[model samples]
Target: MLKEFKKHCDSTSLSAVCTQLTELSNQAFCVNNGNIPKWQSALDDVQNTQPGKLSFKPPYIAIDTKADVSGLTRSLKKLMPWRKGPYQIGALQLNSEWRGDMKWDRVKNHLRPLNGKTVLDVGCGNGYFTYLMSLAGAKIALGVEPFLLFNYQFQAIRSLIKEPIKAFVLPLKLEQLPAQPLFDTVFSMGVLYHQKDHKLHLQQLMDVMKNDAELVLETLIIDQQHGDQIIPEDRYARMRNVWRLPSTNTLQSWLEAAGFKHIKLVDVTKTTPEEQRATHWIGDNTQSIKDFLDPENNNLTIEGLPAPKRAIFICQK
Candidate 1:
């Protein structure tokens, strides 16, 4: 996968930072994570299965391949808590926690064409949407996720595809990326609220984008009724790292302040159980949206804060 990524990078504007990116990724893989052996074992088992054609079968990043269902399931289970996708691999349905397609539907139509464009997907869990971006005609869709397990999950899916797909996921964070104006389209979905400094995060994103590059920012936001923003005193919706939940208006102002132009607030939808529900594929910890919310009031979390409501903002660098 690194070889393919290096080759692809050499063919694009990413050539400037190709060596550095690959080295960082290699170093990440070499880290002493005890789970690596188990994840690698799962990846090996997946690679042994029959390779197949890949497609978008709505609600699934379907892989049309024949395989031993029981064996395949067992191998995939080793990398549990599948959060982003609901993939179909032949007879098995790997139903993930999030029905990612729902979020995709809300943002797909509002984008500029991705055809032949170099793209970046920050915090791209297992490259589900990254694959979609590649399928939507991006020349190359690079997904950078800091989580090591998700990178392994991505490889599991990639190993099943008979043909090489243009999508690739690297085990790296936004702060680790070379500050070169490379990508034409960049996505920061479900990531901003996790940052300690939201403005720094936005600025870092800007530094990596080419002139007129489009950024698709998606994160939790509160309604104006909650005030300009809410700095969570503790956990929000059971997510410990959540720092700030800005109102849509405040978010726009932040974008403007960050030097982004043509800022547009595209969509704001409150999360629902149907979009994020527990499935067997998510392993033993089956708790989900309902568990996080107040049993008496669906509008508030167990912590008495507003429920998870996300907004998508599109702007130009």
Candidate 2:
């Protein structure tokens, strides 16, 4: 495991961590064949990367032009043949123009000041978007996700960000987050619906935000009124409903319940320039999400897709 971690991630202090992890893994593994020794260094790195922080206005980063595919390859090699899903769509909606900060382009009237302030990104997969947020001038931007496979690579990508940017490999339901200062903004994309107890999970999320802290939330909306839908077997590589999409109304109500005063619907699904969204995850089926969005095609057929559309819901406090 330490060898895997070392192969994928690089940092000045990583060699030390690598050594520690190896010793720990061997000791634990030899002691009981019971559990795998898992240690995450990404979250803890935020403190080290955050000193000497400088403030600057962020430049727009349009991803339409080919991203340095090298970075994508680097992340994928470690993460494995994982596929993109609702999270990407939600990000597109937040920054439909793709200037890159996922802060819902030019919505400052509603968004609080974040330039050089601390920002937290939960369930950040691969850290691509987290990097963009840091470039957008967050004093310290931290991502929390539990997959060591990807977190390893995400940490290596931190160097590209001149400002403080860190990745934390933490469980979605982990009871405690770093407890020093509260975050100014939290970006949680497409993660709310994954838990079994929806209300409790939402409350737990609310616990992390400050009184007026911004929350850029996007998730699979399960309409509270209508019954929840399930993904049938075979449609997904995993079992049905690993994702529990929420309805717009339900999300809005939850925001209010959570004390987020201003709630707005950014868009259910955004229309990205076909070229901008092209990737290994999205194939020739340009109509993949488009087909799902057509109102006439709202039905989740035997073919696939619970609904005919991918929607983005950006709500804030």
Candidate 3:
């Protein structure tokens, strides 16, 4: 995958950042993620299946490959707790933790045309949406995910595609990316609230985007009545890394402070069980949206904080 990214950078306008990217990718891959051997084995197992064609089937990022469904399921389950997609490979339907299509439906229509554009997807898990971005006609869709397991998952899917599209997920984070204004469209979805300094995250996002490039920023938010923002004391919904949950107005102000122009708060939808549910793919602890929330009160999390509701803001660099 790192080599593929090197080839991509060498052939595209992104060559300026190639050296830094190569070094960062090498460092990322070498870090001991603990599950490397297990993940590598899973990738190897999937490769035994014949390569197939790819397509975007609205609710699914599907592969038209023929293989034993039992074998496919057995191999894929090794990478448990699939957090981001509902993919299909032949008769096997991998229903992941989240209904990613729901998120896509909310923001897809509002996005700028992807045709021939260079795009970036920050924290892209398994490159599911990255594949969609390429399918939508992006000249190239680069996804940066620091998690090595997800990077392997991306490779697992890519391996099964006869002629995969221009989607590539690298084992790197947004901060590791070279600060160059090259991407025409940037998507930082489900990632911002994890930052200790949300403002810095926004600035880093701005720095990498070309002038007038569109940014689709999506993350958790509190309502206006909550008085601007809530820096969670512990965890918002069972996960620990969450740092800030801002109001839509507060987010818009942050974007303005970061020098983004024409910010539009496009959509605000409360996450529900239907959108994020427990599935077999999620191993041992199959807890999901409902399990994380107070059983008596759906409006609040088990932590007694306001439940998860996300907002999407579209702006220009």
| Candidate number achieving the greatest TM-score relative to the actual structure | 1
| C-alpha local distance difference test of each model | 0.95, 0.45, 0.90
Q: Candidate 1 — worst ten consecutive residues by lDDT sum? A: 7-16
How many clashing pairs in candidate 1? Answer: 0
Query: Which ranges of candidate 3 are over 4 A from the true structure?
Result: none
Rank by lDDT (best first): 1, 3, 2
lDDT of 2 by residue, 110-223 (tens): 445667666777777655556556656666565666544445444433333343333333222223452323566877765665566667665665666666667777665434
lDDT winner between candidates 1 and 2: 1
Tens digits of per-residue lDDT for model 3 on 52-109? 8899896888889888999988888888878889899988899999999999999999
User: lDDT by residue for model 1 over 81-146, one digit each (tens)?
Assistant: 799998999999999999999999999999999999999999999999999999999999999998
Q: Could you give me the TM-score of model 2 versus the true structure?
A: 0.56
Runs off by more than 4 Å, candidate 1:
none
For candidate 3, list the clashing residue pairs, or say none.
none
